[model samples]
Target: MVAVRTARTLGLALALCFFSGAFAGVGTAQEKKAEKAKSKLKISVPQDDAELQIEGKATKPTGTVREFETPDLEVNKAYEYTFSVTWRPNNYTTLTRTKSVEFKGGTADINVDLTKADPKAPDKAVIRWVPTPDDVVEEMLKLGSVKEGDVVYEPGPGDARMLIAAVKKGAKKGVGIEIDAKKAAEATENVKKAKLDEKIKIIEGDALKQGDYSEATVVLLYMGNEFNALLRPILEKQLKPGTRIVSHRFTMGDWAPDKTVPVKGADGDEYMLHLWTVKEKK
Candidate 1:
């Protein structure tokens, strides 16, 4: 009986001793580990009552981490954090932003709103009209020596011609005068050969040179392009009321003529003839 019981009892006693020593060492290690872990997570909050949260891949374990574990440590392995704070306004603006921020490491969006409207929006801008100078017109009106019954004749090309035509039309019944183009004179001569040259006087002089023609109702013009613009200011200043101006070929600078007549040429194409009048001061 003694021989059969000896081996079995001895083996059982040795196994029990090994297990007890292992358990004692494990308990001592657990106490030391807990103390270290408490010091590492020094998560103290400020005076402001803000929410604190944790986020990210480490915090929210997924994929292969589902079954992962440390043989010694019994702590949660995930890590994440979040906080709540007041957002500051920019510059002197009344705009303010408020947000609850997450600890995720990526782009975040913040929205802002204004407490009041922008002060600069109410400012008014100055606007001005850019027309012919008043002095220029005044100078023109001062030259109103020509009476309503005085003769006016068209001269030169371009705007000068237009003014001449306009003045002729606006002149008194027997006052306005017009000189047709050279081509018009030929046409007139073909129709009626007798006294055609006398009726349409082709004066070969630069009308720009100031002179006296009291008998004329208005001066008609069909002069060259360059001369027309050059002579405009002079004509406006010196032209008398009864003495009108008409131009056919070119236009004066920024001048709105009183009338426009469309003439059909030999080719059947239409050309616009402008007429401008010097009105009496209102």
Candidate 2:
């Protein structure tokens, strides 16, 4: 009886071990299945960079992974937005995507997917300040009549960046500037030597509003054709008959000028320099 009881006990122990092993194996399989279901798409960007904005239906699903990369990453400035995306279950790997856009300044949107796919190129967008519609008309008129020795109308000194670029590209450029005592002290040595710091008077008020073109042989208009249209009547009456007006990257609107010259800007923007000499009096 003792030997029979021992054999039975051993059999029960063996049965328990087999069942436990089977259940343990099944539990691991289920856990892996759950993990596969939880896998998701990942989006990444660089730290300390500008915010990545999402619009439209993309904004939903707040739990989606967000990534960052900075403009500094692309030293070449070839791409405005760049990021890597991937997925779990080996469905995807780090994929690089990019889009091209105009130079208009603002937060631009870029969309992506979990499949690690390439997106179409971004539409041509402007990153710079686009003059208003009315300004567009005005700019065309102003740019059409541009000639050498014209004071390019710019509101802020920062606007000089464009003119400086044009000058670097061989456009004869000059500006009437007025510097304050503080600025004069810190002026570049060349500027001081040229007396630009003292003689080029910086207008105390809005330079565009001051209506002071007395010393201007020409007014280089960059405001766009719409604004030029509004200025058509003003130029018709105020400007000297032989005075030259030049415009950049705009078309002449309703105002018919004396002459037009086609030219390319530093960035290759096509512009027509229109010449209007007091619309020769009838």
Candidate 3:
């Protein structure tokens, strides 16, 4: 009877061991399946020194490529992946490029070439040329309080109409920085036609690199939000106290406007104007 009981007990222990091993194997398989469901992104940069950010989170690069792993995603659903790279090439200005791509659940690759992504390229205007309506321009100048002895400056000036009007309104000088050569010539010709060439000057260059707006008593902008953001640092650093910045239909990011006004353009469209005044640096 004792021998028979020992055999039964040993048999029961072996059965329990087998089931435990099987459950452990199942758990391992589930873990592998969970890992397979994750999404992976591979980014390739032109240089190793470039700063990379994925979804606003800073990522460290391994050589020229960085492999980023994300949580599990729905197989058929598309997701937007955004990344930005900041790098300064030898003898060139520092440039930051942001790109977004729609990606499905899988391994994805992105290549960033800084040389081709330069925003200051002569032919590559960041913002399209949209002329502010005559009535809107008048309102913008008035909102900026441009008057005699004021040096009015416009960046990405579509035409010199705003500057001509500013000078005619008793501004001492008007300066326009235009990126496109053709537009610059057209604006210069327009100034000559208005007989204000002596008071107004149109510069053919990239507005982002101009760096000098210290003389501007009133700055006028009709650029988009992105362009305004890129110019904000330069404006704050160079513009003097009491200088007024008037933007038509766009505001600098996070920098609240001192005053905002709404005007009806002659085209029967309502336009918004934002004004920011530079305060004395404490």
Give the candidate number with the greatest lDDT.
3
lDDT of each: 0.32, 0.35, 0.72
lDDT of 2 at 107: 26
Question: Considering every candidate listed, which one attains the maximal TM-score?
Answer: 3
Error of 3 at 145 (Å): 0.6
Worst 10 residues of 2 by lDDT: 15-24
Instruction: Work out candidate 2's RMSD over C-alphas.
Output: 22.8
> How much does candidate 3 score in TM-score?
0.60
User: Which residue segments of model 2 deviate by more than 4 Å?
Assistant: 1-158, 161-195, 265-269, 280-282
Model 3 error, position 49 (Å): 24
| Candidate 1 displacement at residue 74 in angstroms | 99
State how far residue 96 of model 2 sits from its true place (Å): 43
Q: Is candidate 2 or candidate 3 better by TM-score?
A: 3
On residues 39-96, what C-alpha lDDT tens digit does candidate 2 reach at each position? 1113433222212332101121223444321111111122222232211221211112
Candidate 3 at 219: error in angstroms? 0.2
The full ranking of all candidates by lDDT, starting with the best, is 3, 2, 1
Tens-place lDDT per residue, model 3, 1-282, is 111111121121211111112101122344345433344456777578877765565655445765655544434345565567766543323556776655554444434343344444321225667888888999998999999999999997777889998999999999999977889999999999999988998999988886389999999998777677778878999999999999998899999999999998778889999999999999
Q: How much is the lDDT of residue 165 in candidate 1?
A: 27
